[model samples]
Target: MPKSKTKKRSGTDATENRPKRSRQSQGGTPVNSASQGGGDVEARESPLQGHKCLWIMGSSIVHWAERTARLDDPQLGFTKHNMSVKWKGCRGLVFDGLDKLMDSMLMEMPKPQFILIHCGSNDLTSEGVTGKMLIEKIQCSILRYQALFCKTTIIWSSILQRRYWHYAPLGAGKKIEKKRTRVNIAIKSFILKNGGQYIDNNNISAKEVNLFHTDGTHLSSLGNSILINNWKTALQSLINSTPDNSLLTLPTATL
Candidate 1:
């Protein structure tokens, strides 16, 4: 397993100051953290005001949104959390566990009307996982979520290509990129087939990646803003398409 390059904060700082929260209680099965006031606050205020978009993120998404929330939108009332583990990667067994965790979380909270999923990069980096296996894992995760939360709209973000070779073993990075392309092709097919929506982040530049991170693997404040801008455009389209309650009636996926 690859160790996280990021440093861990002191326990006091972690408990007191972290804005991004896990739905699970510490050492427990994942459950929505309403008592902690860490989920969507907008949903709490009148329930009819803003669209409750739950960002079910991977490590990359967590890295991006944590920086972005602090710098750009402190008032942006959305829930950002991670289920992805570094080096464990996005395999069938990993996603099977994620499905159970997510199912437990949804059962406790009102189902989120909108879900944004950013994952699969780690799956490409894993040694034993194949593109076919990655796709099947994602498919299973999606179907499981759909069954649990029948009305949620899902936005599947495309795996953003690396700005430069960040992985090792000579030709390994290229091979990973090739596999990523195949995984994305499968994701696009599945999204189109299931009436879900896709967001392509491959168009983001190396310069943008640099601005977003000190390292290639994570996002900086600037990088997070780029993500939010891109995602917000897609979200606005969905909000414009129907009334708020109609959002709950929309298909399981929307871009």
Candidate 2:
């Protein structure tokens, strides 16, 4: 985590003033401070609007989806179909990784109508974890989210297969590549089984040179275009659909 500065003020004064917000890094999480016990404590609020879509993912999303999203070009009209786009991008973070991002950032946030979840790139590198086991963990997490956020629609983006996997030490890269494929299949199945949507990155291909950077760890400019377009397509449909709040009145995963 990056260190941040918090402005201190008198308790009385703090009550009248809204907390200040600052970004942790160039494209990292936003750090905010609220008054607490004569000091400021880091805090976060729901960044999403009541009706906009939220994208929660890791570094690849930071480079691909978020980069396109942050472009303030007026001609682009960042807003799509009345949706206020929000991105929670962190490098090397996963739902179950060291950061435990899902628990810390999402659990208590204001629920949105749509969300795109793409994580587990770092989890693929964890030792002794098989693809099937990883998928099971992710499934349980989604089930909990459904139980909690009944009206919110979740779209799980597949873990992308990188081109540089062959460059990894010994057989690690190859192993990761194979596991990614299996995990993707499992994710798609789980999402559908639980009545969730799965986004299969259409640009994932060996011939898509513009999709990845030199290290094969991040997305190139062209990659961002492809990803953002995909998001727009998926979001348009959901935004146009009539939402049923009672979809998850009971834990559907148990069924």
Candidate 3:
């Protein structure tokens, strides 16, 4: 994470701060938080108006991509639909750290109708973490979160295939890539089987020119754009998938 001064306090939302909210999405899931740039102010100023709220949460992948998504752009359809979007990104976030991430945000904003999670690439390179082990941990977390969050829809974003595996030995790249595929497949199957949704990001792989930075770990400008585009598309598709607008009514989270 690019260390910065603690962020200024973002004030109350326009919507009535409800007690625990039920979550739902077109396909399923939500987006979250503020971006690295001053997008936090932009999100705070928008009135949620009880419409669909999406919280996009993840690692720096999300932090770097919010400006490109521009969900807060008033001229965009997202604004017209009266949906609220929040992006919560952290540079060094890992898979198991998601619980802590959400816990930290609980009191900051209203519950979102969907939570679109795009993380886990870092865990693949972490010491002693195996693909199967990560998947099992993820399953436990998902079920526990579903129980605690109640109706909150959880959407899994597939980790994009990386050309370089940061922190691993030079020869470990191919092995890590294979693990990435297995992790994605296993998690996707689990999420779908459990009535959740998945965002497939295989298109933004290393094969694409300039999609990744020279480090091959993070995304380049064009790559972030593609990533956000896929997210926006998923948000729209999921929002419109089910006609159960009644499910959009949310309760506040218990602090």
Candidate 4:
């Protein structure tokens, strides 16, 4: 198949329109363009290796270097690299989150054959956001990714439970936990119904696994192992069933 033409944003250079970084440049700012609805559109690329799998997500992924390197082992034929931007609560939903990621990936030296995306916990944590709305946003994001990277199989990772979610002042944390549950349900339904692969991080971490830091927003070391192992299982399942890459090619999982 021919390479898909990359969609462009306003203020993008007509010639290349690529970000300056190699794999990813972690930061708090958005890219240098504007979307149709006035969302910021910054995307940075990582150093490209010969691997065809690309993982993209928010800041939480930056800390998974050791585990991700395991995916690059020659036997697996998967090279994992991340292209994450700065994260703030609900900013991903407000901005064209996946679009930014696509821009970032295309800027890279290698195009991915499989793309895994794990994000939107911030959106779910934001107050007053309905599970339905979060579901819609995620579904739309998946469609956008498929449209741009039609040849790649997209795997959607579930939002994890925050261990400290119930400790926030005024019971705000409890509310967040509820919202997360609702959103996760919607996400699982949507992904499975749409023929996209969904990894249930919640279930994997629920079994006496201390999966988060004391702050409850990030993954602990053991949690990282659990997350990566889940990704491995998901990918391995797909590979086992589809010995020939007919409809889907597997990709790296983003945290």
Candidate 2 per-residue C-alpha lDDT over 60-128 given as tens digits, one digit per residue, 9 for 90 to 100: 555456656567432124364555555677766655752355455555455555657878876776666
Question: Pairing residues by index, what is the TM-score of model 4?
Answer: 0.60
User: How far off is residue 100 in model 2, in Å?
Assistant: 3.4
Give the per-residue lDDT of model 1 (tens digit) for 19-138.
Answer: 232121111011111111112122222143344545444444545464455565532433332111111113222333555545455554555665667776656656577788889888
**Lowest-scoring 10 consecutive residues by lDDT in candidate 1?**
28-37
Better of 2 and 3 by TM-score: 3
Q: Could you estimate the TM-score for every candidate?
A: 0.64, 0.67, 0.73, 0.60
The better-scoring model by lDDT among 1 and 4 is: 1
Cα deviation of 126 in candidate 1 (Å)? 1.0
Q: Which segments of model 4 are wrong by more than 4 Å? A: 1-51, 61-96, 166-169, 204-209, 243-255
RMSD of each: 13.3, 16.2, 14.3, 15.4
Off by over 4 Å in 3: 1-49, 70-77, 244-255
